[model samples]
Target: MCANKKANDDSLIVAIRDLNTHGQGVGVIENDPSGDCQGMICFVDGALPGERISGTLRERKRNYLIVTLDQVLEPSLDRIDSDCRYFPECGSCRLRHLNYPAELAVKEKHVRDLLSRNGLLGHDSPVFKQIMGMKDPLHYRGKSIFPVTSDPAGSGLLIGQYRYGSHDLVDLHDCHIQSRPALALVNRIRELASRDQVTAYDERTHDGTLRHLLIRTGFSSQEIMVVFVVNDRQADEAITSWLPLLKDTIKPLGFALQSSWINDMDTRGNRILSSKYRHLDGSQTIEEIINGVTYRISPDSFFQVNPRQAAVLFDEVIRAAELQPGERVLDLYSGVGAISLQFASAGKELVPPLEVTGVDRVKQAVMDARANAKINELVNLSFIEADATEWLKDYEDNAENQPFDIIVVDPPRKGLDPKALDVLRESGTPEIIYVSCNPATLARDLALLSDVYGIESVQPIDMFPRTTHVETVVLMSRNG
Candidate 1:
């Protein structure tokens, strides 16, 4: 009887056949002999399609569920060795083990499936073109932010990523995702911390000096910015002495200090202790060239992580806008004026008289956008920093700006706020280009807007190649 019971329990094995939008493996139950007749949906971790694994029953809010892959039974052909040393440990990437070409196919299919489900396009509707592959997938990341930890077992500090899904720090001497220069800097920092005896801040104990190390690099210009985050502003003579050595070794554009104070046991309320930073060579900025146009980037400014793919994404947006030379355009959520600058640069050649207004919530981004306008000497371009929803409300109320020819919106992953969508509908912008990173939220928002606006087309661009994430640009027009 005991052996029979064990066999029945073991018979609950399920085969994972697909991946869900959130990167979870999904599978369906094969039979229902008792006629219970309900399809099974399992959320399996670290399991891919064509893999069969036993699952344990789990209780969700109102439903009983089964998740698989406690141990791998059968592996898929697409699975390959992950290049990153931290692969399974780091939760940031899950599909890294999958072949690169297969990964891109999955991303493309995911986007198409999302749009089709929302009735924005038919399954037979043209597949959005696959974004061209990157010149260098490995070491393409130009920025890395690592948390620092004071090793209780060791004398000095360690800087790296947090352990898989936990707050515990994992010391990384080399990260394959980041640029070669960034890896060198990380190694150098670890060496200097040991030599200077600079203690890393411990979040658990709420003690020590260093908290994080932020490194940003402009690959084209080879400009680097190193910002050290500390818990307090105590002047460590050893660390201060090595500042020259750090500069000499890295040749960074800026070295900044971010100091904070931890008050509560939670460590969430830590306040910035220092607000100043020193610029190397009297410059605290880096330059990135996109599509033959150069733009300056500051520490706080926002720019796309993948520069080459960003250009392709922006090109799709511009094409969908069907921009005419003399048309007036409004760009919302314009980070550092990338889209606006592109339009402004081509204003005279495409349209005899073109005007572009860029709006963003970040003051620094607005300032950078305006600065770029000045540098390019684009007279018809302007930038504003304000709550986007509030600005839309005001624009709706005003008679003059009621019907803009074209409006491009690149909201954050959360998608447009409810109020903003309402205002956008009322404003009656003739054309809108909605760029989104999250498909689930994008589908939800598209459903809301579909009542008033007609989706013309959706173009999905693969920004992060080795992952399931995709950047989608959708074009819509008011329903006539």
Candidate 2:
């Protein structure tokens, strides 16, 4: 069929072979000669593996073609009806159509494939452990951001996610993954903004005022923080009038309004928060207790969205470390020192006291990390505001800081910096724990370090369920 079909065929029948990292089904055309797409791969949206789909070619690029699913000729038995109304359009949860167990299987397979492709793991490697899935995955997100725009047909404001791969925002009434208190707070803010005639930001022409509504909730404390991302440096006249009312109005909604802040972002791009922030009302930070440690989250700090799964992920990291007394630990890209604080607390009772040092590029996060250490009364930890790559390179040269007993790196999705990886490979640390959110990047890094370090095990945690994202923790020991 692929050989017979033309580039502009009315419908192309695709038998999905596998899924890509973005949850898109991947298939290949064999001996296709219509437009030189022979042996070219194609990605189909809304198509699951082991299913025959009827789709039309939307975009035909040189490397691959994008297919829009028209009909599922054969659906998999694992497919289930999506509970959320905005299944494919919202693009928030890519695996919402599959059942929980099926989704977990797909994620695990994807991770395994990525690792195998990079030659980091064998097909039946014992080092690759079974994925740790969630028992209850609904409404696990503690943080959500609603981009503000205007309704094209009406005068009301529109607040929700932008359509997948497009700038057009889809107005959402409720979300399955977001917390109830966060959604409720969004509705109340939208109601007030609509009544006050506050303008919504237009990304097309860079017009309007309000850009985004950020709501963060503390699961254990039930405290909420409301942040208004606007386009002006100063507080908008409209926001100054109505934002104060939100402080008194949120208590009845069953969540305490811990704080409210306004972020001035006048840039033209899609960046949500800016460096400039102004505190309007209430306390500056909200607290979340995880693994007997209380973390103070600032308005601009980076914290895990799923609080419950964060504890699970942290526990797995501690178990993997197997620290000894008086051992020195280094945490790279340690935002707000969440993992560093845990290491310090774990060694608080050990003889000579284990020392932990956290390094991050963000100045505010370093500030928060120092403040958090003071808040928890843990003095054996130190925070350094420096680029992780530069810090690692510098540590290698510094005679005093060389030869750390244990090194933990929780790098960004792009994975370890190349220089950082080179330094890590030569550091000769006894133990290294890498926590990564991107499987592809993790595999790439692991392959590079395979010769110098032996990978002990890989534990995949379902941090963001119903989404294609998975958090993995790998323990590696330096080869003698």
Candidate 3:
């Protein structure tokens, strides 16, 4: 409708060419009235490659235009009727509009292009394995953080996802991608709030009580953890008197409440959990077993959201590590020692066993890692609280500590810091197993390590199906 606006140059008709890193369709429009539209590349949401579509311009910057697909005259074979009630509106599943196969292909290209553009995939592109996806992709998310907002119609609290780029909540009772228990628990939480008149926070006025409902579920155990993120710690009568009502209501659903907590957060910045928290009922930690190692997951712990895909991702990591007995392995940014403990457990079959040391900046995670190691009775694994980069440099100087034969680094999306990459590069470690969530950052870090290590294999695991995000594991071997 706004295409005819003087700023938009009417509209641009372009063939959907490829998908960008964010899963948005990329296309180019040749010389046009808009100053930036001359040979300008365009990205349109919900438009697939090979499909000719008319896109109306929304915003233009430098050499690109953010266009809204006006009409998909020719749709791709991959397009399907989305079963989600809130597809395209809800930001959780960016690729659900595409067929399952197309979603996987988009993620595969995202990883490969990031690597190729950064020079990791040189002359000989390694025979990369096909993307591993879920058999039943829907309702696979084990954890969900649903935003609470005042209903637009002005009746009760509206709880659902925030729109893709804004804080506006798309009122929804259930999500298509939440675990069965998660969606059910959401309904129950909304009911409890309405019945007890729990105040939903408003960002504009900085008022109200409840901010969000944070729920985490154990895939195999079927246990549940619920946390109420409130705007402030000022005691709310609804929370004090109504939590027991909530616990009593959901008990018969076959989902055991392993943990329940109240976390006070800021209305601004859209924070999830704050430092101030109190236990409502149940234990402070929930449990999940991965590869025979039981992890006591705390409320704030950074556990993988998808346990099923997690199992697959971890298996790939273990296979890529190729650890042997008597080897010294260092696990960097090892939250809860999942990777470190898994390696140590696998080494048990080998007579010598691996000497594994895990390091993390968070003392709480290190404590949980120690607890996990004890629970699994893995004697070979040890956890230390320290900054990974500084620790490596220290070990390099201190002869007693010595150098690790192998290293496993599972860094956050920001990837390795430059200083960390420097230490990692000069360490001369024989083998390094890198597990990353963001391909762009992974490629950036790999570029730094390319001189000393050669990327042997690259495996992209579809950890979050229907979403743009992907997890990758790479085996980097020292070059002779």
**TM-scores of all predicted structures:** 0.86, 0.93, 0.94
Model 2 lDDT per residue over 1-480, tens place: 233345476566677888787889897643233545545678997888888777776787657788778898889888888898888888688888888888888888877888888667786789888899987898788788889999898767988888877788888879888887777767777787788778888878888888998888898888888889998643366676765576556666677888888998888996888988888778999998889888899887789899889999999999999988999999999999999999999999999999999999999899999999999999999999999879888878887865989999999899987888899997879999999999989999999888999899888899999888999999999988
Put down candidate 1 lDDT per residue, 177-282, tens digits, no spaces. Answer: 6666666777787888787677777655777777776676666666666666666555345555655665666555343222111211214444422344433332
Q: Which residue pairs collide, candidate 3?
A: none
- Which 10-residue window in model 2 sums to the lowest lDDT? 29-38
Top TM-score: which candidate number?
A: 3
Q: Point out the worst 10-residue segment of candidate 1 by lDDT.
A: 257-266
Provide backbone clash counts, one per model: 3, 0, 0
Number of the top lDDT candidate: 2
- Taken over the whole model, the C-alpha lDDT of each candidate is 0.70, 0.85, 0.82
Q: Order candidates by TM-score, high to low.
A: 3, 2, 1
Candidate 3 Cα deviation (angstroms), residue 113 = 1.2
lDDT of 3 by residue, 145-181 (tens): 8889877787778888988877788877666678877
The candidate with the higher TM-score, 1 or 3, is 3
Clashing pairs in 1: 259-273, 325-350, 325-351
Backbone steric clashes in candidate 2, count: 0
TM-score, model 1 to reference: 0.86
